[model samples]
Target: MAFGDASFLSRVRGFLIPIGLALLPCAIAPAFGAAALPEEVTVVAKGSGLFNIELETTVYRPEGPGPFPIVVINHGKAPGNPRFQGRYRPAIAARFFLARGYAVVVPMRQGFSKSSGSYIVGGCNVEGNGREQANDVVAALDWATAQPWADKSRILVVGQSHGGWTTLAFGTRGYPGVKGLVDFAGGLRQENCTSWQQGLISGAGNYGAQTTVPSLWFYGDNDSYWPTPTWKSMFEQYVAGGAKARMVAFGSFASDSHTMFGSPAGAPIWQPQVQAFLQEIGLPYEPQPAFAQYAADPAPVASGFAAIDETDRLPDASPAALEGYRVFLSHQNPRAFAFSAKGGWGSGWGRGDTRARALENCTKKAPEGACQLYAVDDEVVWAVKP
Candidate 1:
């Protein structure tokens, strides 16, 4: 059979099984256990007409008492498949945060998972699958915040691929209490530019410009589906529009097989960065001890941008601070200039004064026009010459 035939067949099979099982509920075995059990709960969210839509959520709470920060994670496009939900469990990321203290909620959208309603994709209704999914998230947050164990003030929304697209949609609608967002390979447009198409509809308007919530967008440089240039351009537009946004590209692939975020190699690089991002925005969680150490000992800020003579100017003086500096430069939208840390008199002339000032004055040095200082978090600092 053709690919479209196969997909349609799969959907039909899934739809049939659920309907058949509903008629004979006992045929399905229970999978509930401490390991499998989430702080399970249900809520009826306001949907179209008099029919109240039922939303099923799995809540994972941290060890502490009182209210803890919350992160609402949404599943990707294959909402009806248990396998899909199983793959994107918030518990994986939740355990990391729960160790530091956070409550995670994974909700099933209408017609997907245990939630009531048919799965509508593409723009079928004003509140189709995408919007309904987003609404489920908002409602989950509402439910979580009201709980005695959740911290209403510090909430974050994280989604990957299709879920990432959902996150962007939900964010544009302006959900209250969301302070930060982590988007891993989230889709922004519906051109089938990427392979991981979830049949979800794109929201109206440019989401990049509308997103004001502080967010981090991650994609593998080699991501096969979405090209880096397109991703970067979208993010750049968002940033240009005064949105608090940051983009981090890993490897050099167009699509990192959609698993870079969860890969063993990728985890080490991204997990800490994500933790740092959360901490940077005051997410109310502790970083893992090892990751915390990494955060605490960011490579030292290099000094001596002004003392070197012109003849001795080295081509790469700011090697130690390159990464942090790059992040700073990208966010500030500074003019392009050659970067050199080598000591030299002429080295600081061509570069703008603002760049010089920002990287100067580390380790008790006076603020001079020779160098500029850029600080990252409270640990890492870098000096660049103008």
Candidate 2:
């Protein structure tokens, strides 16, 4: 599914709802230690043809700067929602970058929030979405670079989901000062999704495989919409095309879903990875130990599955149930695997359980294996394996 597709939104909603439930109460607390709230602003500019354009932005700056490295974080589809934009989106990850002394800008795009202009679903191309959103991002970069507080040379563009594709589009086409690119669940290949194809058609390969900038791509193994095979192929193609690209896939959908980066689950996983990538690319920034702590800590299981008891062996479970359990086990840590019923079963069976179960049963099912009953929520995910 394309990032802009209706199905993508459904997946995003599925991922974000759980995160929102988990983190909404803690929103008031300091999500990151020593991280300060960003200063918000609305900048107005004149677009082509006397169109009044308003760009909503949140800027974070570290103390004492001789032009700090600037990272621009573009928002995903639900830009009008403040909860997702400034409070819950990739901008939150930008905070980690800011805490490390990089200047981070989260733009609301053209049509979302207080930003002016028509809404364009796929804006990578010149004519679609607001062509101005891309240009405005570049303009924001220009404004930042010119600032006495900003560094002109080191600039990074990071996007999540829709923004991920935007990062490739803008960075590959050559944003003036973009030193590096980070795509969190961003689709780089047109073949990866219809939205990417739409973008390719709209932008005319503006950010194609020819990009030479060093980039880091992240995705979730269980992202139902964009399967693992498609994501891996996209990265391989980019690497083959000479783009300095590296990809890391997380075990499950917790940090792999479309909206994962902005979630509480995502903050700890991605913040440090991005920071290290920035540092490696020569971006100026002070390192923070908090991200290290975050990395050291294991993420909590997403709340959707029933707790399983390991004392029991494979029960009268169905072939589908056993396979689901195994797939979940394959993704767990060795220590977690030792826990069997709890760890091996995974956090919970997501909407993809049906498909996952089918794949598992097809791959591993013995005529004699006891079909254990696997309870997921109120329903039996599958009846196999203890």
What clash count goes with each model? 25, 17
Model 2 TM-score, 2 decimals? 0.58
lDDT of 1 by residue, 1-386 (tens): 11123232232111000000011111111111112213444443535457666666656654447577788877665424532343234333544565566677767666666676666554533224445456666666666777777777778888876677677667766665677778787763445334223222223225545565667778777665566665666566555654566677765531243555433234566677787777666676565452221121122333544332221343435554444334443432221122323321111111112222233223122223233233322222335434
Residues 69-129, model 2: lDDT tens digits: 7888876654244333332233345556655667776666666666667565452343243
The ten-residue window of minimal lDDT in model 1 covers 13-22
Candidate 2 stretches greater than 4 Å from native? 1-35, 44-49, 79-91, 122-133, 187-206, 285-386
lDDT of each: 0.50, 0.51
Tell me model 2's lDDT, rounded to 2 decimals: 0.51
* Candidate 1, position 252, lDDT: 56
User: How well does each candidate superpose onto the true structure, as a TM-score?
Assistant: 0.56, 0.58
lDDT of 1 at 210: 59
